[model samples]
Target: MSIKSFAAKIFAGYIRKKIDNWASRPVEVQEKVFRKLIKKGRSTKFGKDHDFLNISNHKEFAEKVPVRDYEELRFYVDKMVAGEPDILWPGKPLYYAKTSGTTSGAKYIPLTRDSMPTHIEAARNAILCYIAETGNSRFVDGKMIFLQGSPEMEEKNGVKLGRLSGIVAHYVPAYLQRNRLPSWETNCIEDWESKVDAIVEETRNENMTVISGIPSWVQMYFENLKARTGKPVGELFPNFNLFIYGGVNYEPYRAKFENLIGRKVDSIELFPASEGFFAFQDKQNEKGMLLQLNSGIFYEFIKADEFFEEKPKRLTIGEVETGVNYVLIISSTAGLWAYNIGDTVQFTSLSPYRVIVSGRIKHFISAFGEHVIAKEVEEAMQEATSSTGARITEFSVAPQITPEGDELPYHEWFIEFEKEPENMDVFRDVLDKTLQEQNSYYFDLIEGKILQKLKISTMPANGFQDYMRSIGKLGGQNKLPRLSNDRKIAEQLEKIKKQ
Candidate 1:
């Protein structure tokens, strides 16, 4: 390894120690860390000046910064596309990571060399820890496959050559570069749609040991692969050993993924966003994901119940609590200060600071006049599954409001599961009861019968992938969107309905 690569590892180890120490403390100790966070918020320039951009400092400032949706970032990204310097950050960003925001409206998120190191450190450190935990240094000698997004895309200001995954590929340490799946497209492709066929073709015959990408997309890619090879996926790529996934949950497609490949492969979850990489599964127990908070960014959390309307109690690395879900806010080297990434997670145990991501707070339905958050949905789903002895592989709940004459006024679920319920009527009743007991809104809806019926659409095995594939969004960073609240989301639903 070069000096930089060697140094990165050493720095990662040091940061890991701090995280472990903080995670292991008592609840009181964790509370103390929040006090320190308030002090730091006052000192940082990025934390204080950019009112709209910075939110983590909400506790210190009486007038909290406004939450910006993706459109607000679009103008800044357009400026970056125009080759403008120091628009969003203090210095010039390297380029943008083109991503599908809320629509087909592709967004080019600004990324600078200074900002990128955080992503590198967080991701690389997670990889190193995984190797240490699993004793799987085979990555050092074996080839790895990354199911990346479009290698390129057109920016809002008309500049091309914007691809976050490709840019990351460009900056990775050289020693590891040789072990990657060979792709000249990684260097040349500038628009995402232009290279889909080539990317699919590149993996046809390789000694692939690891596969990394979003669950839905990876499933779609292999489904396509099976069509091309005219053989079971196992026969086409027998050497594949592991599946590394992030950006979305993998529970829904787990059984299908194993069955398709015809071998038991290690599965890992990575929690990353457009801002930077945040956490990864430490080990394979389905326990808690280890966070790389200090590696690349400054991290804090707000109480789950504390919306922006209320004063959010921010927690530092040391000041987190177990069982209570908190919202994540981060300040990164890229200059995002107190940025709320809209994720809700809770600590399982502190010793190592293992956390379980509950889900997105913004992605829940609050119809029937009761506020139903993502955490409640997850718990109710779990309860329903346990009671029925049925495992839900994948499920999504869309909240809908109907007119007075309409029958169902609350919500609907499009669920994909491995086995059909033995007694359909009993299964539905059990699930509805579980939700009603777990959440007040659900219970109210059932008691009043205001939401007349709950519709459950059972999908074919691996059906979620088909949904994602139809939209051309299949890779890491492309999530199975939880609650489709926007108007366009309805259109997407109609497409699925037609399909």
Candidate 2:
């Protein structure tokens, strides 16, 4: 590694020490520290310039800065794209993380230098906590795997276009960049046809120690790993020690991953988003996730009912309660004041500020732990239908829970298309297989109790799209809803099934 990269790791280690010192404190001390940090956040340069920072004190600030959603951030993004920073902070942002939207259409989440440290620090602490809990100290020694987007830069000389992941690669610590298993530029699975297959090939025989990234992608890798290697993951990489996953729940995907590896793997849940890393799983079981609040952003939580019923009421770390879900809001140096990230979480304990991701406030699915929030389910369906070599034009998923008499709840997938899916049965099987593999709870529930079927319907090619358009949701920032809470959606789907 270059001297600069080595220096970066040292700097990160210093930051980790400080995090440990603070985190090691009693709950009361942590709360006191949190208050001091909030006050400091209010006095920071970003707070001074923005009107949103006008609260008289931290207490008042927490009370007044209502919880916000992505829609609120979209307004700022619009201004940022137009070259207006809105005085929320100093300096221009680097780029936006292009993520799929839930209630809205596609979203371009802004990422800036000042705001990135939280993500960096949180990720680092997550590693530290994992080490603390697992007592396996060989973090830097083994091959690590990250299933993620291509790191290809978007544009070089304004000519060839690439991916955003590559751009962020430049900012990673040099040591990490070198140790990263898949070389960013050389190993991207750009050709849509060979993506999963290629990923499986890339991971084979690497003597991997750590694994990370989105659950869906990891599931794909494991499935293909089993196919190509003829051995489950545990047999293939006996040295694998830790599973670091985020971007979705680990519970639903846990059993299958363990089964693939053929052994128990220590795991950590991370809460990194395009914007920043908010919190990470605590080292102790039953201790809620620990928020890296002191790193880069100031956090505020809105009570569950208040967040839903009226303008959200923000609570500082001191006022937070145990076992109740709250909407997460952050004010970051990256120029966002009072930004509401869509996730909802519940605190399990206070001393360490441990929390669990409960659900999304809106536009997210609550069933199957598929992480099938509005956007992911849409993207997966689109990808599957397009790649299946079938003429499928539309689809939906309604989560159903059977009464207590039944063993498990069923997830009814509604499909509508002109022609029967070319390899209809195979496609259905693929869909079921993929969902179960991607979502652990779905897999476990299915194996244990729920015997859901892949329900298919034949409609005109545009039938589903036409219905979405009729609902006045065809255009900008909208999508046909999937993973509905009410059984009415399934009932409607059944009508289409019978048609």
Best by TM-score: 1
Q: Candidate 1 regions off by >4 Å?
A: 1-89, 103-108, 153-161, 186-200, 234-236, 308-311, 373-395, 403-410, 416-440, 447-453, 458-477, 485-492
TM-score of each: 0.76, 0.67
Instruction: Report the lDDT tens digits of candidate 2 across residue range 70-133.
Output: 6865655665555654334455566666666656876666566666656665776777655555
Highest lDDT: give the candidate number: 1
Can you tell me which runs of candidate 2 are displaced by over 4 Å?
A: 1-17, 24-54, 59-66, 155-168, 191-193, 284-287, 363-483, 486-499
For model 1, state the Cα shift of residue 288 in Å: 2.2
lDDT of 1 by residue, 123-155 (tens): 666666665556555545556777675454444
